[model samples]
Target: MLIVHVAVTVLLGIGAFFLLVGSIGLLRFPDFYTRLHATGKCDTLGGGLIILGAMIYHLFQYPETLLVSAKLAFLIFFVFIANPTATHAIMKAAYKTGVKPWRLGEERR
Candidate 1:
């Protein structure tokens, strides 16, 4: 359906936009923790949106592919859970290893 196609297109575009912003943040942020925060948040959202778009498109375009949609849903769930957890773990490790947080008036790391 035309509506479905339009929705899919919009979702894909927005997802791509978030991904681009995340990558830019990764490159531009001064500190490692800030960069990780940007990427961890944005990547989870962007990837979920993209996968959701794909799932919706597949559902409407090919009703037979229900299993695929289910898998995509699982993938989205995994990303949502894994990304933040991994980010926290890495941040904790950095702190334990004496990686200091960026302070105001300090030179970029």
Candidate 2:
């Protein structure tokens, strides 16, 4: 049980780190497309890991309660489906609107 708790805590910490990185990337990245790449990939992974940690904690601490477990499961499922779809939609819209990428060789204006 102690090990399980520690593991979950570590996972949550890692997720938080990823979330912070994503937020910083969103703010610091030069272009919309780059920001999207960071937020979409890093934030999604962060959220997923956080949710997984929560689910694991719940499952271990309340083994007899199905309600919490069920809710956590639903959360995982919803995030998994919604995050990528939302990212894809945003990227597609950006592409459609001709939001160009920042070329590596080009100097920042």
TM-scores, all models, native as reference? 0.96, 0.89
Please, what are the lDDT tens digits per residue for candidate 2 over residues 12-104? 999999999999999988888888889988887899899999989988998899798889878878887898899999899989998788899
What pairs collide in candidate 2?
Answer: none
lDDT of 1: 0.93
In angstroms, what RMSD does candidate 1 have relative to the true structure? 0.8
Q: Tell me the spans in candidate 1 whose CA falls farther than 4 Å from its real position.
A: none
**Candidate 1 lDDT tens digits, 32-65:** 9899988999998998999999999999999987
Runs off by more than 4 Å, candidate 2: 107-109
Q: How many residue pairs clash in all the candidates, one count each? A: 0, 0
Local distance difference test scores for all models = 0.93, 0.88
